[model samples]
Target: MLIKKIKRRIYNLFHPIQGELWCLHRVLNEKSVFDENKDLEISPDYLETKIKHYKANNFDFISIDDVYSKRLSEFRYCWQKKFINITFDDGFEDIYNNAYPILKKYNIPFTIYLSTDFVDRKPLIWWLVLERIVLTKENVVLSSGVIYTCPDIISKRSVFKQLCDLIYNEPDNPADTFRRLFSNYVSYFEEKTANTLTWEQILEMCDSGFCTIGSHTVTHPVLTRQQENEVRREIEESKRIIEKKLQQEVLHFSYPYSFWNEQVQDIVLESGYKTAAMGYGGSCRYNKDNVYKLPRVYLVEEST
Candidate 1:
């Protein structure tokens, strides 16, 4: 973490962020109920603090569009004027439920990279599925006679990571591989309670002039894990679907789970995203930077 902060500062020195993008996942409504992944969420109060901090710090809050369009010829060593662009990945409904009002109140311009499948309800998000399966039940047996038990939170977390790696290593259809394992332990899992943002909610935000929705891909698979053709299809299909559904040009793409490579970057450009955000944590002079691999810093409140 310290190393990353150093690198971010170093990168910012050269490609000073006229409009730097900071990424977040969810802003939690209930701390206890949605407590499975605190790493992915922050209280709305904390988010409010962050907004107020930037406001007081003389930072200009700008949109991703502004980064690409307005701020090109302004890199300096003594960078006095800084900008913050907010982005959220995974399309959590909590952003609409909790974060949006605060952001709207502050008049912040932010973008959401929507995982279309999570919103569409075709397949379950595998990580969430794994968390539930491991946490809610103590002794678990797989269909293949593999025995697993998570007697405590630490054990459960470790088990979840193991399952995550197993799923990630699958050569074909990781989602299906996860589904088969999850189905074996189905009774312990409840239906997904924290729903994704609906089209109605998204449209309302779009009309409000504060929200910009971008594609995070259908099924939210790791792009590098799939075949070449499938990778292209994921890129093209997601952009096409969002534009068709939202009636807005989905001009930006964020690689699902911040996973991308040379091939993935090319596919994103070919599919016509004006900019693609990645989470390697740095800022770039966006004048004519590599739009396909725009680096973004993950924003979480510092621990006291």
Candidate 2:
């Protein structure tokens, strides 16, 4: 791991990534490698390390809107320096708490794609509930009639992963099964108190000029699993809500769970988002080439 970090630093210095859109999930002060969704998180200090690294390498911290407006050649004028667009997914409160300060300190521009319901006092993220369910319960009897006995944290992690994959791959509405699991283990009142970023915090960020807010859909559903009308409503309503609250044009959209199809792309475009971000790993060569489905490399503590 140390060697990989060294190599990456070397590459950042020697072989700078040009026009990279880096996607991050949550940033907290915790350094433990084992935690709920550890792979999706980085310590606040580690986030600063990355920010400093990019700064030292002369990377321009660009926003999603900037990418949409500028041509690749016209924008990336620096022959040696690279340009990066930093984005955070899911709108975790930690992003407002831990990350916003680090980013504010560096004066780096960034965007957050919000799962509106996650923030808007509605249903909380089911996956987090799933994680809690697996960790706390010694044994689980799933609706499928399979019994999982997680005797330790290791076993819990393994079982949690299997169940998560199973939920995602199932042919039915995964939300229904996830709710069933949540109720079986976690309290419905917990759903009411899933305090994500509040409207005031989001407004402050938008007013800061360093942050741009984008839509991450209403309920953060896997769009492919829903019907066309449902998907359209998900894409449209989220953007509408942000625009209404912020009183500014919300111009970017991101796929919830990095799940996007042709239908999803068409809806995002039709809904007036100028550019949208998607997951998995790669750099965008040109903005116009992938305005709707921009590729991003997810930043994690351990390099692969």
Candidate 3:
């Protein structure tokens, strides 16, 4: 392990990454061990540790706009100055409650990609509902007559992953499919508590000057599976809604679930977004051609 670590350090020293755009989902205190989306979250302590580590390592913390400008600049004077930008997807209220304070402490500039419908209290956040059902009920019987029995944390996690795969890969509308599957158990739409960031919270973040708003589509649909018009509407209308709500031109976007094709890419370009982030791919290299498809590393607890 020591040898491998030394080798990696040497390799990285010679071939440093241009920038790292971290894609984070939620920053909150952990809940149940059986939480299916546990991987999507990291504790506030972990987030602070990451920020401190990067700062100690000489990584220049910057915004997505800085990323765009640096990548576009033809002159290369400071190749050794590595940069990292942080961004959150889905506009979760946990960010405002948990991550915001830590980020503010460090004076970090981050971006939040908002799905308008989520903020609008729409039933699009089906995954959280699905988790609640699995945890509360020992046996869940889908409307399709398929039954999942999650008697323990291990089984609960298994069931959640299985159902989540089905939801994401569902040929029909995934959100609608979630409702149809759980129609008998509970109504997916009416959450008594707000889970997403409100426009008020968003406005406050905007005022902070440390937060940048980006579009994550109106309903956070898998664009590749959607109809051409639906895809266009999801990409274009989301930009419009966010721009109007924030009263600022939304220049950046992120694919819902990182599911996109060339057609989806074209729509983002046509929609006038300067850049779009995706779920996977490691540190971003300065590439002018990949402006629309800027890759990001998901900053889970395991991320370095």
The model with the greatest TM-score is 3
Better of 2 and 3 by lDDT: 3
lDDT of each: 0.77, 0.77, 0.83
Cα-based TM-score, every candidate: 0.86, 0.87, 0.89
lDDT of residue 120 for candidate 2: 47
C-alpha RMSD values across all candidates: 3.9, 5.5, 3.8
Least accurate 10 contiguous residues by lDDT in model 3: 70-79
Q: Report the lDDT tens digits of candidate 1 across residue range 1-304.
A: 9999999887766666555688888897454222335557788889999899889988888877776666545564435777788899988788899989998999999899988876746346566766666767797667677877789877777777677778777765666787676667665445764678888888888889988988898778889878989898888887888889888788888987677789888888888888899865666663536778787777765444
lDDT of 2 by residue, 168-220 (tens): 77766667767664455556327442348889899898899989999999888
Better of 2 and 3 by TM-score: 3
Compared with the true structure, the alpha-carbon lDDT of candidate 1 equals 0.77
lDDT tens digits by residue: candidate 3, 150-260: 999788889988998888777876888898788876654575423788899999988998999999998888788888999999988988888888889999999988987
What TM-score does structure 1 among the candidates reach? 0.86
Off by over 4 Å in 2: 1-17, 31-36, 71-78, 120-122, 181-183, 186-194
Q: Model 2, poorest ten-residue lDDT window?
A: 71-80
What order do you get sorting by TM-score, best first? 3, 2, 1
- Backbone Cα, N, C clashes tallied per candidate: 0, 0, 0
Quality of model 2 by C-alpha lDDT: 0.77
Error of 2 at 221 (Å): 0.5
